[model samples]
Target: MKATIERATLLKSLGHVQSVVERRNTIPILSNVLIDASADGTIRLMATDLDLQIVENVQAQVEVAGATTVSAHTLFDIARKLPEGSQVRIEAADGKMLVQAGRARFNLQTLPRDDFPVIAEGPLPTSFELPATALVQIIDKTRFAISTEETRYYLNGIFLHVAEDPAPVLKAAATDGHRLARVTVARPDGAEGMPDIIIPRKCIAELRKLLDEVDGSVHIDLSPSKIRFDLGNAVLTSKLIDGTFPDYSRVIPTGNDKLLKIDPRSFEEGVDRVATIATEKTRAVKMAVEKDKITLSVTSPENGTAAEEVPGDYSSAPIEIGFNARYLLDILGQIEGDSVEVHLADAAAPTLIREGEKATALYVLMPMRV
Candidate 1:
């Protein structure tokens, strides 16, 4: 393979594809990226770890049309350190790949292209396009709630499906047993009959990073077992989690009578200050809500006790609830509005939170015993 590409362009493309390559791999080919130079003036780079794959295309000057495999991280590092605007020349012959730019030159070992595995592309029946901004919002609001516990594999990803609340809407939800977050947006065209799927945690993270620089709409093709995202010059394909997600609707409380509206900034600050004295294991903060103020307090056997009062608009009966400080801060950070609405049932029941009474995004926290 022989091709010439700009240093910046090559580095950007490598950054997108090389992240999928595992640092330590039992299989030799899995650690390398397949670089295919075509006579049509473009080079395609592909890297995968069996479950997830990323393919990126960059414009380059192709001298000889061929394909070779080289260490993805090594090539990325070489391109990253190259001076700005330097032209990178890559040529592979005799099981060796020569990389040269400016005053730097490195000979990297090449593996046979035939050894690289290509994930099979099956027919994907459902197709839809979502605005980049909407996709970003969906991921940002719910991804933090995704469970890291490997035993409950189904909860290790965001649950994406279409919900019909009089009108069809696309919803993304994640839960880690202690907290649940749900966000919804208007469903895109051709998504009415889409099957519910759990997008794995790693795939969600990689896709989120790729979306940072993207604008316009992203094309998505989905099946029961696999999903493919078509970013303008890059394509990502990932396998969906096979397990079934729990029925999250049942967990959301619908009969909470008390309403408390408070400034998210003040509430967050109070929680942070009070939790400073909380036990390291629980990190729990107790909230005592009254007519017009909420008292946040924490007591630790080793560290003393702390308390603070935050103003609120609560007229219902007083209630005391205990919650994980980190989880409370996470949900508060997602609140886009100035005021956050807190719905309380009791100290033992789950509490609901939202930006407003009719907001599309909602959060539920299971209270802890103080």
Candidate 2:
């Protein structure tokens, strides 16, 4: 394989695909990226970890139509260090690949392209195109709640499905037992009968990065077991978690009537300051809500105590609740509006949070004893 590509363009494409390659691999080919140069003036860079794969195509001057495999990290590092505006020449022969730019040169061993494992995408029947902004909003607002526990593999991703909250809406939700995040957007044209699927955490994270550089919309194709995302020149295919997500609707409380509205920025700051004195394990903070103010306090045997009063609008009967300070800050960070609404039934029941009264994003956090 031989091709010539700009340093910046090559580096960016390599950066996208190489992230799928594992640093430590039992199979040598899994550590390398497949470089395919076509006569039509483009080069394809593909990398995979058996479960997830990313293929990126970049415009280049192709001199030969051939394919070869080379260390993904090594090529990325070389391309990254090349000077700006330099032309990169890549050629493979005699089981080695040569990379040259200006005065720097390096020869790296190549693996046979046939040895690379390809995750077969059987048939993705469910396909839809959604605006990139809507997709980004769904991921950014909920991914923080994805679980990392290995045993509950089903909870390690975001649950995506269409919902009928009086009308059809596309929803994405994630939870780690302690906290839950759910965001919804108007249902798109082609997503009416789509099946519910759990998108793994790692895939959500990697896909999020790609979406940052993309505009317009993204094409998504999926089956019960796999999903494929087409973002212009880049395509990402990932295996879905083969497990059932819990009935999240049952966990979302609907009878919480007490309402307290507070400035999100002030509440966030107060929670952060008092959390410094909270225990390292629990990170608990106590909130004593009155008619006009909410007092946040924390106590730790090793770190002493701290307290701060955040002004809020509350007219219901007074209630005291304890919560994990870190979780409170996380939900607060996602509130984009000026005011944050906290609906409470009591200290033991789960607390519901949202950005004012009409926000599409909803967060539920379970309280912890202080």
How many backbone clashes does every candidate have?
A: 0, 0
Q: Give the Cα error of residue 268 in candidate 2, in Å.
A: 0.4
lDDT of 2 by residue, 24-77 (tens): 998899999999999999898999999999998999999998999999999999
What TM value does model 1 have?
A: 0.98
Residue pairs clashing, model 1:
none
lDDT of each: 0.94, 0.93
lDDT of 1: 0.94
> For all the candidates, what are their Cα RMSDs to the real structure?
1.0, 0.9
lDDT of 1 at 362: 98
lDDT for residue 141 in candidate 2, whole number 0-100:
97
